[model samples]
Target: MPPSLPSPSSVTRAAITLPILARAASTTSAGTAVTPNKPPPSKDHHVHTYSPEAFPLGYTVSSTHAGIKKKAGALDLGILVSTSDTPCSAAACMTRNVFKAAPVTVTSELLRNSNGRAKGFIINSGCANAVTGKKGLEDAWSMSNTTTSQLPPSGAQSDKEGTLVMSTGVIGQHLPISSILDKIPELIRTLDDSPKSWLDLSKAFMTTDTFPKLRAKTFKIGDRLIRMAGIDKGAGMIAPNMGPPQPPHATLLGVIATDAAIKPEDLQNALNYAVDRSFNNITVDGDMSTNDTILCLANGAAGSAEHGGRETEEKMKELTEKANPEEFGIFKEQLREFAEELAQLVVRDGEGATKFVTIRVKGAPTYEIANAVAKSVANSSLFKTAMYGEDANWGRILCAVGYTPLSPNPISPTSVSVSFLPPAASSNTTPLRLLTNGEPEPNIDEARASEILKEEDLEIEIDLGDGNEEAKVWTCDFSHEYVTINGSAEEEEGWMYD
Candidate 1:
């Protein structure tokens, strides 16, 4: 396991209060649920208002109200620029949906053409340039070109300083290209390396997100301190299929900036490892969007140039091959933790979702089977509804697992078992064992199981007893509000900002 973060007492008081304040401000009217329309508090505690800054050096963020969103003054366009003297090395993972958006196409081309180097990112919310065909492509290209033209001379680096674009909101709509272009100058002028700027950038990219999602951590390689800060916007349509360094997608847009001096290829490898274990392991409504994207930029502002020369490629290759385990492990762990935290936040704030559910499938014949089984359970409407109702309905889970089409390896009913574990705060309570060897436990306490299911976070463990392989997935309970929110998404788009 990665090292545990020090308790807030060991860190700073803000470390404990910031997340609480952010979470509190994001709650629905009932104070327990999350809704897409709730705007973040005006005085966000997540900003560097108290102690300990939230971002790495050499990175600045800015946002502007481009009049794309229905609400006046709601920030709809944003940019994050890496101001390192040298070009920033970038790694990205985009959605695998075949029907990708225009911005996704442009981002893929830029990553390919520029060879994984970028100066900054340009993002817009409230008008997803998806399914708009030729015109959409031109508009996306225009966004990048206009943003690039506004950069200072030092910030521009020929083809090396590629600009990535991300758009999220109403699909099949053309972007307000003129408004976005007009705001470019102001956006660039407001860029600052402050925590408030990062927080604003996070909020600027939200479509239906109830709160700004941001996380930051500081780690050390040798004696030099390196910081990794990330912000993401996603609340629904969030089953991200983001694969290794690729393109872009919709709904989810994450940007992680680090000051660690690492090669682009190595950064890509680290991002892939982290994404597979984090974003790829989560599901919210199980509807993958056309514009899911996660981008990581390393500007090496910390000056740990131990891996900055031509020999760096060979060293990175060795690290990838596990020939140099220590340094590679440190980088991989830090990146994974960063990605995992953001991914979990996405699920925790799943639109109208009341409970966070973790589905763990164990004893499968192979990891692939375990993963499939976990996803089947995680995405099951019956299981999710049961969870939301706090019902100890283990049969729904078994049905989901059994119908997963595992091909030739038929599951043996007699070898199945299931258990429900409550949240960590209730450690004094024992896990409720619902099944044993495919038979309902004779001493099962249905009331206890139902009570445990009422917790905000739940863990359902399934044992196939087929083999030793295991996989885990994160999901959320499906409530009536989930259906209501999605059902009205189109009709209520204009009023969501109210």
Candidate 2:
């Protein structure tokens, strides 16, 4: 692990009390969940707030200048620990890339062996330790074992503290193990829970991200207050399509810690649902990373029947058919919203990207088709370049839709319509139709089109005019800076393993 660690400098509202969000199923991402913009049905506006910046109870993070990056004294190696005495429930969505990083392979086994329980995890940014074959795997194990050595161990040899590992940056390179392991004890000794610590930790793990990406959510399980916080880093080699401890993962990279009590199976299910709708729905440059991983740990520090910072060991109900659906629904939505916020941050900070675009493909025959078409348009280099130049090149967008292997046969060029939606907070209620029924508009409002595309954030709406199924994907525009950065990356000391 060589590239990143979170350096947290977050602000927490001690008085913050989040309102209850409704449990009813609604329409949104992947054509199933609630829309990212839709607020909870509750009259109160506090049901969801994006950046509470508070770490959940019982979690601590720290990073050190491990010299993993080429930059002198840059904080690289970091550790995030679930400090509860009991083994914390853990779940992950890992990259589907066949050339999985050494850390990824080791962490997968750790989770598999521990049965969804873990204590602490470590991440490094600099050398990805990918494509190094057996020796790379050994280094990953060393990273895990070294981390386990610092923290108190958990049950069973198969479950040795669940010391998961993650790495990012230059591919096919060996980690400076001695240089990193020397700092592991110091990282542990300096572990902290301060907002500044979280901010620093967030920044440490970042590669090309201009700013640290982190968010927090709060809710109540009965009278007990539950909190969820997440931090992630990635500015390139993104487009996470992770599975539930299966073939793939997303976000490029993310770590979520929560105090909400949940069962192992329920935790896995919630992560799968949230990730598929959020992280899996985004693409920046359409590149999949070998080390992409998102791990969620719940220490249950604020479980029911607790107060004054004391965590109860009492078993809480896991989300299941036998449990309360409302509470479970709220948990899943909060998790999704948290992941979505972080995932969006990845796009907003995409390397050399100047615009964040949302592609909404509606009236499709199926959710999969809608998703595929939307991603196809979002990932089109021509379309992205057009957006970069503030050009309403709607043909480029539609052409992207034309070649989709998953497209419907009836969806001829004439079967679709394309429009540029107004930017967020803009007063314009009407969309500027660039192409309607697959025909270019007779009188193009070039001025208005320029105005819409000039904004830093843009929205593209495509109507297949086929069926009710719809999907939304988030992406960024291509720019000359993207090329410049990639061109000189290797000489600059490191580049992400795409």
Candidate 1, residues 103-212, lDDT tens digits: the string is 88998888878878888899999988888899999999999988887787554356556789998888877888998899999999988977777778888888777778
The lDDT values for all models are 0.76, 0.75
Q: Candidate 1: where are CA atoms >4 Å away?
A: 1-52, 155-158, 245-250, 303-324, 489-498
Task: Kindly list the per-residue Cα lDDT of model 2 for residues 1-498, writing each as its tens digit.
Answer: 111211111101210221111222355656753312211122122122343234587888899888888788777788898876555888999888787888888888888777888887898877788888889999999988888877755333234456889887788788999998898999889988887777777767777666777677667767667887788888788888788675323127889999876776788888998998889999988888888899999876775534633456664445552476787788888899889888888888787777889999999988888988899888889788777766565656756776666612435556788888997687775788877786667776677777787677799999998899999899988777777767674632644443
lDDT of 2 at 279: 92
**Highest-scoring model, lDDT:** 1
TM-score of every candidate relative to the true structure: 0.84, 0.84
Count of clashing pairs, candidate 1: 5
Residue 364's lDDT within candidate 2 is: 92
Residue pairs that clash (backbone atoms under 3 angstroms), model 1: 249-291, 249-292, 250-290, 250-291, 250-292
Worst 10-residue lDDT window for candidate 1 reads 16-25
Q: For candidate 2, what is the TM-score?
A: 0.84
Pick out the ten consecutive residues of candidate 2 with the lowest summed lDDT: 6-15
